[model samples]
Target: MKSITRYLVINISIWALLAALSAGVILTSLFRTSAEDAFDGQLDMVLKMLVGELATQLFSSEELSRPGSLGQPRFELPLSGWYWTVSRSNKDELVFASLSLGGENLTVESQSEKQYTGGIGRYLMGKGPDGKRIRILEREISFGPDQSYYFRVTGNAAELDEQIRSFENRAWLLMVLFGVVLLTASLLLVRTALRPLTKLQRRVRDVAIGKSEAIVGSYPVEVDGLVEEANILISSNKETLERARTQLGNLAHALKTPLSVITNEVRSSDLQNADMLVQQVDVMRDQIQLYLDRARFAARHNTIGTVTKADPVLKKLTGVMSKIHPEKMVDYECSADSDICFRGEEQDLEEMIGNLVDNACKWASSRVVVSLTEGLEEAAVKRPQKKNANVRKWLSIIVEDDGPGISEGKIDEALKRGKRLDESKPGSGLGLSIVTEIANLYQGTFSLERASLGGLRAELVLPAIKEE
Candidate 1:
């Protein structure tokens, strides 16, 4: 998937998870509240039943002075899980109290109607009993006129806590399952939505690998734009390839026609002048063919992956010059902060630098200095015109000669194809032209100016190639 669409899927999935978790927590809390209220209601009914039975038994009893009667539970059936204590007061004093003992005794401060029924509410608290923490549910119970008789009921809160804990655990488990289901559903949705894009990708790959000429399927509107762009690029590249091929074919055909004419003319000439004339014609043919070959080399593929390293070029050139002209001195200097490179064909880079260095060697009296720096100057040369900030990361090579330089106004024409300043100089003018084209393809710059050493200085500024 494209970056934006992938992010959208991930973001939606995350929000869905958070929402699911929030809902799970709220629902779990609500379930626990409902369960607690139902359990509390049951507990209140049990307490009310016990209070009613105890009031009836106490009013009919003839053993009111006995402590055993006070300790006896009135209703045994409803008090299955309940604990209780009863106390009697005479003249605002505890005249009688129950013998049931456990954690703490509930104290009654006053006689009021509020103490008779649901006087005090239950709350959670922990009490230390026998060096152990005991969670208890406590409430005060009052009976009879003047509310002098009081009862306190306490129950273990462990069962209620367990119920809440179990509910929370189950809720979390369900939430996790829901989240997984939601994530799986989201991924399926993303996949189904991107199926058309995947088909487009496969078609484009087929075209790239030369398995097909173009995209081969109907696509969605969202994907139509990308398909159209791909088709345009492929068409443009094919046109360029065809044009280059045609130009080469025409150049060959033109040269062959001239060769055929020369052969015919040689056969018609007298034997005396035939050999010299044929030799001259052969030389012309060779020169024409050489220029054509250079032209083909100059028509480089713009997307060719080539990286030019200055140090390697300098090393190769210096090594060659040291072997060929051992008696002559050559010095290589570089002021570049780092290695300067360019994204162009390696053969083209070799030819460009080789031509400049070879020309420098011919003109240098004793020393030929090659310097590499990285920076931009104002655009002067028209062939490889500089444009874009990306070109500023350029490799500028300055080849200086100590010997006499080119005459004024000749440097401009030297770069033009087949324009040689000196006929006596044993070289084709195709070198600079090839270099200019290579630089132009990468949007680099080239210039020929007078060196401070009173000799010709050739400057080649090419865009830097970033190392992977």
Candidate 2:
């Protein structure tokens, strides 16, 4: 069976991991983009400084290198990966350059750097004169109407790469940690959410197997509605059965007196076939009795649940039977646990055992052996894969003797109602039928097989319970 808690936990964990990974990707991208935009903004400021602050200084200088500090001092150091240059537009002629250029002209791989221009100022990534990766910002500036020069400012791209790489590593690490926390939280929440459901299932199963009358204890508000509905359903079912039993009893009372009146009137009257009428009336009474017996057994099998100790019952029955059949040596053996019990009314258990023992004593030549043993039913042998779930218990009773046993082919036939193999037995052949009917009511089995004691073996298996 699929577990609800396991299903919920697994699905929640999968979604949590997916969401965390997607968040990591998106967060890292945004961080890197913000850092890159800030880095480009600083470079753009320096480009403005070169155009506004040093435009006149460069135009009047003959050597095109007289500068103390243009924007930052790093541009004055040779091969510092920060430089600036002014060149004639529409030509590759350098007019003025920063000191950090080291006498080498500034040029881009394409018509510009590794990237293209968009608006007034263009951003590009390219190799600088120092053989280091740099970001270049280029723009064509006109000091007058005709004279135009290209201004380019360069900065180190390696710094931006390092900062973005560091942020990516940290972001992925945080995402992984958050995913673990999320999965852990999901596991706890799933178990907590399902705890009440698990308890309710056990209670329902216990009620089904006659361990409890109905669900017990308080629960969360979310589960209280389900508990109420379940209790209602269980109570309604038992009530319906009880009402049906009451109605059937009322019907019996309504019919029984009338039936008795007809039988008595027919007998007292001088009818042509008075004996025949009495016999038919007797049969009708027998039929009604049989119907009521079936109805009673039907009501009992679904009883809320009761426990009856078997040891005392077995001891009492065997003692009574020894005196009832003094000529026959009737006995009993119990290999079952001391605490083993029947999961039904004491009378039902007595009824099934009494029929078997009585029949055994009737037919046994000398001795009879009645034994009880712990046994597992064929259907309940395989256990359910659940925790705290009840496993049904069962027991077997075998009654055998030394008398002549019936044939194997007649075993099934003998269980039929009114199937008297030998009329000389002085019975209506309803003992085994009654036993079978009651056994079936408890969802039990009754069979006749050759006993090891050289006689018929009546093996009855019924639902049982432990004392605890």
Candidate 3:
């Protein structure tokens, strides 16, 4: 699944793009309208000025064949796309024209009375003498009888088009720049807004890895309730597991006492069935012990903030093993990294390491070796120099002895619960089995192999806490 930050960023970016597009469209439209309006205003002024000039000539009885200049140089240049015309309304004949027309006429449409205002003129889009698009403004006026004329002024539509196109280009560029700024600001805002959540996530990881006991730090009011609830949930789960472990211990004690009594009673009896009853009782006791061990491991395996240093645990276990097997004349060798720690309950670590070291002591003729090291599988095999905390690492606890090691075929059988080989040896065959079960509960691995010491090698790989 995608993270919340990515989901929110994508959604916000999409909306921002949509809003920018909408703004661009609106701005482009307004720019075009304003450009056209400015063009029409220029044509209106020219048309009114031409009408006043023509009226002055008519009232003064001046026989002017051409209209005077309207103070715009383009009007005097031929095919310059700026032109004016004065024509008789009755005969539809051109009476006067600007020099810029170059002897070609401007196309004028017939206008209705309602189309023209009393003082204001009518504006239109039309073709000029040079066949270019143009804006035209026309007005009709009368000085006397047989003196009515239409005055029309036109400007090139291309200029207005160029101006609008230039405005659109700049407008779009600005909008794109604005969009980029907006998106950058939004991303920064999102990161800042979610910083508290990121802190919460790191604290939760710390709790899981036994670096801290509970969630800590101030959070936003919006997520403060969630933080409190998570702390409550952690406390509740710990309490529940503690209660369950206590109940399981009580149950195991209660059952074992009665089972022990039954076993003793059967042993004292002389009947033929008594031996069979004793055997069955012993089997029941073994089964109870196995299951009780499993129950304890299962209850404590996932407890948060539980850490055990391997050096102290290994030292203590090896010391106990040395005392237990003093007559074996075993020379015990033990070494462990002080910084290495197990991310689990201390008793569980004791149980697993104790079983392996005890088994090595039991079988060793003269020497037993126990070693603890932190390693990644890939690094252990190939690159031992590089260390990556994000990669999975294991705490390898290896016990090797100089006694007779089992063949590869029987190693699997040896790990099975209650499957004792060489019954002459005083053991219920649950040692390796219990170690295997605890390793499995911790999401670890166990293997048996030929030892460097010329006997059995029992190796355990359990999850290790990464160094900060």
Give the number of the best model, judged by lDDT.
Answer: 3
Question: Candidate order by lDDT, highest to lowest?
Answer: 3, 2, 1
Ranking by TM-score: 3, 2, 1
Give lDDT tens digits, candidate 2, residues 136-241. Answer: 8888888766668788888888888899999999999999999999999989888888888888888876786567888987789998999899888889878977
The digit string of per-residue lDDT tens for model 3 on 94-143 reads: 88889889888987554424343437567767788777877777777777
* Deviation (Å) of 396 in candidate 2: 5.6
**Each prediction's whole-model lDDT (CA):** 0.63, 0.78, 0.82
TM-score of each: 0.48, 0.73, 0.77
**Residue pairs with clashing backbones, model 2:** none
| CA-only RMSD, every prediction | 11.3, 5.4, 5.6
User: What is the lDDT, from 0 to 100, of the residue 44 in candidate 2?
Assistant: 76
- lDDT by residue (tens digit), candidate 1, 393-450: 5666777888888776887788887777778766766677767766665566677888
Candidate achieving the largest TM-score = 3
